[model samples]
Target: MVRALSFCAASPPAAGPHRIGAGRSSEVFAEGPDRVVKLYRQPFEPEAVVNELAASRLAHGFGLPVPEAFGIVGRAGRTGILFVRLDGAPMTVRYAYNPLGLLPALRRVARIQHAIHACPAPGLPSQHARLRHQIEGARVPEPLRRAALAALDRLPVGDRLCHGDVHPGNVIATGAGLHLIDWQKASAGDPAADVARSELMLRYGRLGPAWFSRLFPVRMARRLIAAWYVASYRAASGLPNEAIAAWRLPVAVSRLFGRPSDTDAELLAAIAALARQRPDSESASLFSGPGRSPGRGQPECCR
Candidate 1:
């Protein structure tokens, strides 16, 4: 999982390497009071390390709120990236313990996303290409995939930077400010599409237990948060709902691949229904649900 870590300044720099946090791709360790090492898990490729390193440096150059990636190293057959550490709690974790903070947390993340979109993106890959790749590879029905792909081609292309995955889990609320992590999925694309992807992550991305989301209250909370996040983001960016809605089909299909968690039953049922209708048809209004957007990088969901 993406983690928001807190570090103590009093800790000596000479302290030995200790585990701090772990995610699907790598395990993080505290290298010192100001630095951490993100060591990729075994059986992974060096390309991932190269992608993340390049992405991080690009983000840093753009003046986004991201940790500085120092360099890459190999240790015990695992590749790692040395990064300047930030001290904070993940906005999701904080809101989980206290639901009252959810709205403000959502607003904070939305604002950060707007800022990220404001930056010029010259060196990133095409978000359109990434979306097409994921949608094509999804295990959905052939007809459904074709419809989504067709709709994607008809959608507008944009020139903004998109943090392909920017759910609360990737947003860390640190003392300095709200710092975002996990840039492996960062790409150049439409801000509206990026916002849609963020909404999908908040809606369907696994939070606690798979069963926990089945509860009425849990689902309700997710629904509200997703709605408000989109609303706030829309207000800030002036992106139309129709623009965001147009991307929902292919984005939803893209979620089916490279995800580690069990697929939610609600999502499957929704996709099954939408598969029967043309994405641009009025009948496809069923996709107005508050989830879905394109995927990027290994482990598509970027959880």
Candidate 2:
């Protein structure tokens, strides 16, 4: 615990601690101007919080846009971490009300993702290790699982900082710019795999009620936004689209185990499609030659 603060209610009772945001794993409550507490819901354990605290401090020390994690605190039988409160609405919430901002917000997040990769964080856990563990344990067919493992073994390992997860909901739109939250999944690895994970989440990760995302227009919009995000990242990093596509198969497989049921089918179909394509012998890339690529077709980054 680094400068830990007690969880008991503080002064200014008129505007006391209250819930500011809620997610599947945790609820955030504002403690004061400088700090907020992210309280994990039932069946919580200390390991994730411990990881978040370490990862957050490391990211902050590296001058990344991550919030400073203070330490862990217990309250009402739940575990929470105190963080330097950031003032902003999540990028997804902002876009929910202003659909027009969707493009710019995604583009900005792409740049943020690229910037994150530029800063190396070798002290963090291995992204490759996590992918291997998850893919081996995923519910996909054995052939697909073996293919994913082979694909994982083929991709180049890197030492760049990886957020591991970067859906729109994880980014906050602040006055300064977009800030990334949720550090439990932070790790160090290839930027391409990280970008693939971001693309997968943006394209299929659930944001709201399933009914809303199932709508035809909403589904199309999700595809466009995800494509735009990749285009932006490609422009900034000059990382070949082939590399990102190669990573998509394994990353999608790794994500299937614990995601919402709505995302599983799409991921499975995409994984199967990528696996069917005979990759280049030299590079083993599923993407090649002028075609926009299956399931990942979108606006050209070359423009």
- The alpha-carbon lDDT assigned to residue 256 of candidate 1 equals 73
Best by TM-score: 1
lDDT (Cα, tens digit) per residue for candidate 2, span 1-303:
001122222222223457677667787777776788889878775776887787778778767777888888886777899888777777766677787888787777877777778777757778898899999899899999999999999988788778888777787777777778888788889988998888777777875566776788877777777777777777766777777877878898898775346657766887898888764431443332122232433222211
- For every model shown, what is its TM-score relative to the native structure? 0.85, 0.84
What do the candidate models score in CA lDDT, each in turn? 0.72, 0.73
Compute the lDDT for candidate 1.
0.72
What are the clashing pairs of model 1? 251-293
Model 1 alpha-carbon miss at residue 61, Å: 2.0
* Number of the top-ranking candidate, with lDDT as the measure: 2
- Give per-residue lDDT, candidate 2, residue 116: 79
